[model samples]
Target: MLLANVPITVINRTYSSEHKLISFADTNTLLEICDKFQRPFLHFWTTEQPTLILGINDRHLPNLAAGLKGLAVNHYDYFLRNSGGLAVISDPKVLNVSLFIPTATHNYSIDQAYQIVADLIQTIFPSLTIAVHEIANSYCPGKFDLSVNGQKIAGIAQRRTQRALVLMLYMSIAGDQDGRSDTVAQFYEQGDAYRQDRWHFPKVDKATMTTLANLVSLDISVEAVEDQITTALAAQENAIDLSSAPELLRSAQFINEQATQLKKIQLRNNQLPIV
Candidate 1:
């Protein structure tokens, strides 16, 4: 089903420089909202700090310590995400979106969830010829990587609970795409210098990645893209501002549950040796 067919609560969030980790906690809280309220959510968020988010497998790299040290030496903050996919960069210039849909009524297939985000992206940038395929040697390469003229500009990943699914996407809207890719490449190079691990990490190539600004003639800002997205979804009559519902935020149960989820996220991140 198209996204327009579902009623979604829209949330726009910005995190402080030191609180980028809270973004993950917020997502977890939204999952709880999905379970309790049985409502879909479309969350858009950005962080003031540049972060190198590693996936579950990254913690098992043969020389993970050396890789994390490299990131620190380069003045980059790194964390392990409780999700699948290799390392990817998230900064002020990158736009992160999550679509949380409850599956209690409709069992959306994996491909269907991916296609929903792809369709939304296509609606946002109609001028570009978007392709859905793995861009070899690109950071966080996946079958659903959204590319323009063979260079990846965005990637999609999925996380599901018992009753809801969240499709997470990170789009390189405006920034030094090459620098971001190079950082990830170097991390993998240093982390698996010996190449002895059974699981192969990507050998990221900077040329295989491009930002949305580079692919289009228009000047792109995160806010502009966000406005366009909200406008598009609103036109379809599928969006409701989550902030308008003050009762949800003021609920004691919500406050306690969100705090618990945040603590869990903190614990998970703290368990990583890099911390």
Candidate 2:
């Protein structure tokens, strides 16, 4: 199951400040209806405002209230993502790419899904020596964290259902990498004041992370990165317009399903006890 042989549907759009959560919900919605298209869907998006995205485990923090208060005090808006991975920064400087693949015909293993995105990233930046491993003291550190010379640049996470899978990558293209790390590290400090959850929360060190702009001489802006990704997948491009595809975004089933997903997100976030 080579990526080049699979059809790709690219949806490039931006989410406003208030509607940022919709971006995630849309991905969930697409994954639910992915079988109807019988192809992979690539969604490229960025948020208008900076947001702190928490993972499922973050909800279980012993001092979750202090964590939420710290975020509010710092003027940060956050939500628990349906996907896995600890808190990650999502702002205009970051470029998020989500690939939703239908598995009705071919089943994809966990490593296969991660490899697909890693391969695409390598293709986009062929000049750099990108390493795939966990970067010590980096936020959201994982086995699939993409790094350059020990400095983490991007992290990948995935959410899988029986019929489909959505692989998400948050690439730090051009921004203050250290400041982003600091923000997350501080959140952990406040969330786990006693450091009781040391093993669960990462001890982020700003030195362990970096942005793509600092690594390559190429134009590493978010827009440029998006263009590079598009070119990398050009062979499998099967562009679709949502306005014309009723079965995808306009059909009754899609509409109801998306609404339901959105409601679930709202309930999850709203039900969290605030200190």
Candidate 3:
């Protein structure tokens, strides 16, 4: 309900921004960037190459070959993302946005983060028929899925490091939800059937999920979503471009150390690594 209270002042910050999404064959570089940049930024890009992203602690494989590679699904690779949440489909269409908000600016609980997203979407389509409620039985179900008529349109996850909290979520702009759910369901099945461990996969439903393009009766492209994010973020602060930062470059060794230590200690209570 507070979605509209996201001060227009923040939205009016630097009307022009240079936020661009870069593709990845592996998530290591992205993770490195996220850990290194202690500021707010956004991007929307995807890989032409397929990589089956495993949860940080999703080791139903237990060091065994898992995902498409193990099943010989052809051309698909398997690697872990340095974050929370289970598998979902990612490509150019699944527009990904990361907002690294300083805790000092606003203390964010999970709900507050979702509210920020809800507010942004509301800004884009102020009159669109939609609801920001939890979608039950959806893949990676969280409190922040923007839905329409009980079908999910997004899944959100937050990654916090020290005082900076990064909320990473996907707006499935155009894709086969049923197809993506099938891939996740099969991955869970394979990981469970092949490895001798009890692990939980996101309960994805082919019918309960969809994309923004599908949610609205309009034809939406990933490029459109990218523009919307640039707009929303520009409203927040005088965003600096992602130019080559020597200081950021110099901090890599230390950043990697922090990341490694975080991952090593994150695997508690039988949970997978966060990446």
Reference-based lDDT, each prediction: 0.82, 0.80, 0.55
Off by over 4 Å in 2: 1-7, 197-199, 236-251
- Residues 1-275 of candidate 2 have per-residue lDDT tens digits of 24423556677768886887788888888887675665667788888878888887788777788888887787777777777668899989999998887777778889988988898899888899999999968988899999999999999988887878888999999877887888888888887834673547788999999998898854668888877777767744534333333345667887888899998888887867765
In terms of lDDT, model 2 sits at 0.80
User: Cα RMSD for candidate 1?
Assistant: 2.1
Q: Count the backbone clashes (under 3 Å) in each candidate.
A: 0, 0, 11
**Candidate 3 lDDT over residue span 75-190, tens digit each:** 44444455676665665566656554555445677777767777777677665666876776676676777777788777677766555565666777887777776776676666
Cα lDDT, model 2, residue 152: 92
Residue 57, model 2: lDDT of 74
State the displacement of the C-alpha of residue 3, model 1, in Å, after optimal TM-score superposition.
4.7
Considering lDDT, where higher is better, how would the candidates rank from best to worst? 1, 2, 3
Q: How does model 2 score by TM-score? A: 0.90
lDDT of 1 by residue, 7-112 (tens): 6777788887577677887788888888667777888888777779988878778888889898888878887676777889988999999888888877889998
